[model samples]
Target: MVGLTLLALFIRLNAQDGILLYPDSYQFLLVIRGLAESIPLDAAMGAGGDAWSAPFYRLGYPILAFPLHLVIADPETAAKALSLAAGTAAVPVVYVLARLALRSRVAAIGAGLVTALSFSLANWSNFVMPEATAVFLLTLSMLLAYLTGRAGRAVAVAAALTTALLVFVRFEMLLVVPSLVAFIALGAGQERSKVLPAVRLYLTSLAGLIAAFALALWWAFGGVMSGLSVDPTSLFQAHVIESTTAAHQGAPALSGLRDFLDREPLLILAGGMGLALALRRRPDQRWALWLQMLPLLLLYGLRNDMRYFALLVPALAYASGLALDEGWAALRRLATSQRAAPALAVSATASLVVLTIVFWQTDLTN
Candidate 1:
């Protein structure tokens, strides 16, 4: 885990030419600077000037980055630093999730290693945006949700809190609510009697936390809903209904998936095969994880933004690791029967490594 994390950090560090800032990055930087300097929310919202909102409503990322900003005295560097830290930290979280899903240390290690080398994850870590942090929190939420069955009440509470925090980071993350509920409802494994109570407990805790968070925001800002400038109905119509209609009309439905496959062919192929195997094997938590990924996949598939697919990197890497592990196991079984199997396995593994390197280089150039 330690090695994988360091490798992830190293890749992110070398992948950039200093801090990469975007239009959205400036919004976050303004908020981080405002928070660090004790500027009020309303003042911070207008800090950007020219009527550009400072993302005060999704304040979680800037709030977390403020301490770094205070020390570094550079909001851009601080924001990127926070992103790098979160992205690197996700390595172990991905490994843990893989371990829970596959129940194999080798597969878990493979997942961590693949995540470390992921170009998309590395690219996002280089940017001063909320994506890296959101991905980390999302992965953590998935882990906590997976743990609820084994750890019971405490884990359920933790999952709820994490889910609430995730939503705070990215309001769109509220889409995860149904998936989380499904996970909790079916988390108790074969303990059919415990499922309902566990789901109820999680829902109650999540509701309370969300309410408390809203109340705190309202008290601090003088109002909660007033800070948000977006109209929910319009946003839904534009982002959801319109996007879907457009996709069906002319835009390719699977463009986003195709973009990812072109960039990370081996990883995508392996992940697809692994997911197919998981479906056949029907692992205990397979459906929970799949449910969690469904909404994101659908949304991004419609949007066709490859960058948004970064959110799915860890999960895909986990599935890739599972596929690789299964392949190795099959080869081992063949090796016991045929003398040439060992040579074939070695050749196949070498080819995969070389191909992965080629893909990584191509992605870096792009």
Candidate 2:
């Protein structure tokens, strides 16, 4: 299934429609090409003043593309290639995460296929951005932290490194690390003695990550404070925080849930059902899922942009796959089992294919 998923994504991504998908794609290409031309990192910018440091996004994507820029000659092609590879690699990682969490082969494969075929997901691969890579690393980190009931130091270290790298890939990933630590600590099983050590290891790894990020920033920006100040404090502002927590009138609150439902109705229905199922049957997994999704949720509520919703697709797809798989299973037991099972599977598969095409077309036409 993993191999097939990879092939499917590769074929899709490799097909060029000659559309420059997003503004970010052009910026990424500029950065990659500039760096290849020996332009300083801080000086890498687009013709339109899209600076490398204006809002202080992570540098991992451009840095990772340097070798590709050197080898591929065309910066856009290199960037697309990078996204394609990262997005393709994420399929197996998504499978591992779903399989580990649900302990169900059908659910895991379904998740993998959903992720692989998702137009929103595959769209990332066809573009020149870090989202696909970020998704891949983020899912890998989640899997590493949860694969065992009690993770050892090596697993903790690996998970931490993956997460830290993910942060470098995209700064928003930083928001979820604390919750991830909590998730890792809970994975230490029921042994009280093992719990403290596990917590210590995860925290220490987190500290190491922070220090590494600080050092990288300091080197790039010339000082820790300077690097930190690249983005204004307003960057942290959100409608939920402003309305409910801070009760500030500076920015009007908005309904992210409503916007998501309006934009991606199918995903909202299936993913919401999946989420309810998780809350009911796999309460232990809820924290991790929330952490994975909360940043995007906040972004949606604050900005009301549907584009950020793509970041939540991995969790949504995983949850939806579980719901779809289990729902079909229960239906099979209640009726003419074999025939109903095939019918349900066929219908679900067809629905997914149609949704994928629709999403791709929508994004492209936009």
Candidate 3:
């Protein structure tokens, strides 16, 4: 099943870069190209010619893609390779998350299926963006938090460090770190019945966060070889704030959200339905749901367009799965007394409507 998901993931891979949607991807490619061409990592390349040669592109993607310099001839080919690898790595992480959350093979399989078949993953799996890598790390990071009880502090620390790397992969992920920390702290407190152990564990995990920041600095500032700001909040504010603030950005946050609400009302209904399910069982799971929900959820009412609200896809899809699973369970019980078909029909119709609109919009964009 998981293998099939990877196959599904691989088939959607594409090497194209379109700056109109988001220009930073090309800049990243340029950075990798510079390293491939043996350009001095320190020298700042002008934004017009090769914006990527600057220090900000120095993150882990270059390190991971370095081997491509020796092999792939085409620049796009090389970039695609790394992106594919990252997207591929995310598959098992989703599987692991499913196993941890549901603890049932069928449910885990279902969860993994929902994650892998995500149209967003399919569309951008091979696109020259760090989204796949960042998402992979995000899933891993969440998995680590979910597994905090079973794993030792050292393991949790390592997972936190990986998530720290994700912060560089995509700045929006940083928003979830607090919820994630809360998730970890709450779990630790419950297990040991002491807050100090959880505190120690949480602090130890900060090492990974520090390491991630150091790597990001090196990537952005040329790893001690160039001059660039190392401040953490720089990218976060710029990408999420300024880009969205652009007068007519492709994915304007609020307007897009309004369009979604006005057009595809079902997705919102589905999300609400899913939230209700998560709320019902394992009240403790509420925080995990919230941790997974926050970063992308806040953009809901603000989405000016579909693409602008894209960050919500994975999180929402997970919610959809939760809703689907929970809804089905309730329907099963409802079947004994009343009509389960109506509930099933409603979820299916809502999901189908949402998917259809999104797919149509995607084709129109193409």
Task: Provide the overall lDDT of each model, using Cα atoms, as 2-decimal numbers.
Answer: 0.71, 0.64, 0.57
Top-TM-score structure, candidate number = 1
Predicted model with the maximum lDDT: 1
lDDT of 3 at 269: 58
lDDT, candidate 1, 198-265, per-residue tens: 67788899889987886775566443224344443543343344334333336576766677767766
Mind giving the per-residue lDDT tens digits that candidate 3 earns over 1-366? 558465545455432344232455566665677667755443344444432232262366654565685599776677677766766666667666655565545445545654555545545556666666666677777677656644546456766777667665555566776666655654554565443454367556666576757766466436433433445466444455533454355745467666545543443555556667767874655666676676566644454544434455444544555666665677778777667677777768966976675555333134
lDDT score, candidate 3, position 137: 73
lDDT of model number 3: 0.57
Better of 1 and 2 by lDDT: 1
Report the Cα RMSD per candidate.
4.1, 5.5, 4.8
Count backbone overlaps in model 3. 14
**TM, every model:** 0.83, 0.76, 0.74
- For model 1, what is the C-alpha lDDT against the true structure? 0.71
Between prediction 1 and prediction 3, the one with superior TM-score is 1
What ranking emerges by TM-score with the best candidate at the front? Answer: 1, 2, 3
2 against 3, candidate with superior TM-score: 2
Give the range where candidate 1 is weakest over 10 consecutive residues by summed lDDT: 43-52
Over 1-366, each residue of candidate 2 has an lDDT whose tens digit, in order, gives 657476547655555476465755666665566557755444334445533432235467877876888999888888778888887777787787777667677788767766765555566677777778787777777777664226566577777778778877766667777556546655654554665566577668867986787577556544322323344243234212322332233534454444555555455666777888867876766776666676667655554333455677778777776777777577667557557767777778977975665455435334
- At residue 200, candidate 3 shows an lDDT of 64
